[model samples]
Target: MFQPTGQKRLTNVSVIRYKRGRKRFEIACYPSTVLSYRAGHLKDLSEVLQVDEVFENVSKGKVAASGDLRECFGTTDRAKIIRQILERGELQVSERERQYGLRNSLQEIANIIAAKTVSRATQRPIPVGLVYKALQEAHFSVQPTRSVKAQALEAIRLLQQHSELDLERARMRLRVHVPAQHDAKRLQERLVQIETDAAKKAKRGEVGSAAQVAAGASVRGGSDTSASLQMVQVESEEWLTGGALLWTLQIDPGWFRTLEQIVAEETHGSGTVEVISLRVLHEGDHLNDVL
Candidate 1:
């Protein structure tokens, strides 16, 4: 059995362990300090380490053997070895810490929901506190694998199901004439950022959602108008050089009044607005806010 080194005990400690081949090395660090260093918030390396000694077994307070360190690391420089381990080690956190981190990420989902959506009645953004309350009432949990926006969208679904809030994404669809180059360019910029194929071409799916993969994909340039290409597709040979375009776009409703002003100003009051249907979206309302 290895003799314990009888070092001073620590509270809220986590072990960062690195393994190579069949050998292992470890360091005991204060949980909060280690993350700060890793996140580049702490510059002094010594501040993060508890004992400043590499260990063979942290639980038993057993320091690593010098011979083993030399054989594995090719040098016995303690600082170099410790730096390597910290740079490429597995941080071991307790279950309570794990759950706490998850709660923070889930709360991020609530924040996203509040930012991208509004109360249907007031047409005003829902406050973050109330959104957080709705999340708890719906029993939402952290899904580490999914994007924050996707999870927030799912939480909104649950809120609607429970009738907790009559909230709509702050978005609207419009059928309007777009000016070539200027307005059309602005409109195309907001087009569904599509997924690419092996050939690097935009893979066409149902035209409703611009962001197909929720794996950190972006939501923009607009939405779900499976209205046939004949009806919904932007019409123009080349919209860049003053060719007129009849386009259907989905965008934040807040952008509507602004768009009307731009159109009328640019067209000298000749441009007009027409409404098709302002769809109070159901499941897949694309969003752009980041967490």
Candidate 2:
């Protein structure tokens, strides 16, 4: 052993091991970083590796022989060899770690849902616990490697069909055809202003009513805005012929009437608002039960 484990510190260390012939190469990596690196979300090696040095035996802190690097990679450069090891190595993830990751991802999906959705009747943001209960009831198979937003969308669909809880998505998905160029601009500005005001109120701890709290909630991965990134996100936008605009929006259900007013005012009652799907939320009592 080159050094005792007590003498070294590698917090949350996970090993990525590569083998060639009788020689085994290893790198100490950040446990949390391996999945992201493997998914290609992270490219920089420095961000992944805990220590730059390749190891013959990581637990013992024994460095690999220089000749082995040349034999395997045809180069003695430590950085290059480490890169190859990282690329080809099998990351060692235990069942426990995987379960932990699954839990975290499930919670994240629940959070995004809570932030974006509300009770159809009360128009209040659903508590995180209630979202989890719905997920559990729906038998959502939480996949840690999957996108949370995509999972959230799927969860909504599943909850509507299978779970006891119901949601209001029909009123939220609006297909609008603005008759003029300026009308689209006006509609976007009005919705943005509403979101900005709500987000500011949320930050200031002014959640006085159910509607207010729902409006104040943030869209975790839904909107592209810098500040509020609020509701009424543009799902699709296209400029139509003869100076008109067509749009598909995913918005807060609570804003349906306000949206109707905005659309009516902007297009002077000429634009069409198409509705897609609706699943009623009649679970305020259930939400309390879960909480």
- Provide C-alpha RMSD values for all models, in order: 10.5, 14.0
Worst-scoring 10-residue span by lDDT in model 1: 193-202
lDDT of 2 at 243: 74
With a 3 Å backbone cut-off (N, CA, C), the pairs that clash in candidate 2 are: 167-279, 170-277
TM-score of each: 0.54, 0.52
Residue 76 local lDDT, model 1: 91
Model 1 lDDT per residue over 1-291, tens place: 544354434456789999977999998887767666766888776788887888887876678889999999999999999988888998887889889877887789888888777776555667888988888887888775467777887777678668568875655556677655555444443332222221123234332332221112223323333222211233222333457666555544434565566566655665565655454343334323222
User: How does model 2 score by TM-score?
Assistant: 0.52
> Model 1 reaches what TM-score against the true structure?
0.54
lDDT of 1 at 209: 32
**Candidate 1 clashes between residue pairs 3 or more apart in a chain or in different chains:** 190-221, 191-221, 208-223, 208-224
Residue 59: error of model 2 in Å?
2.8
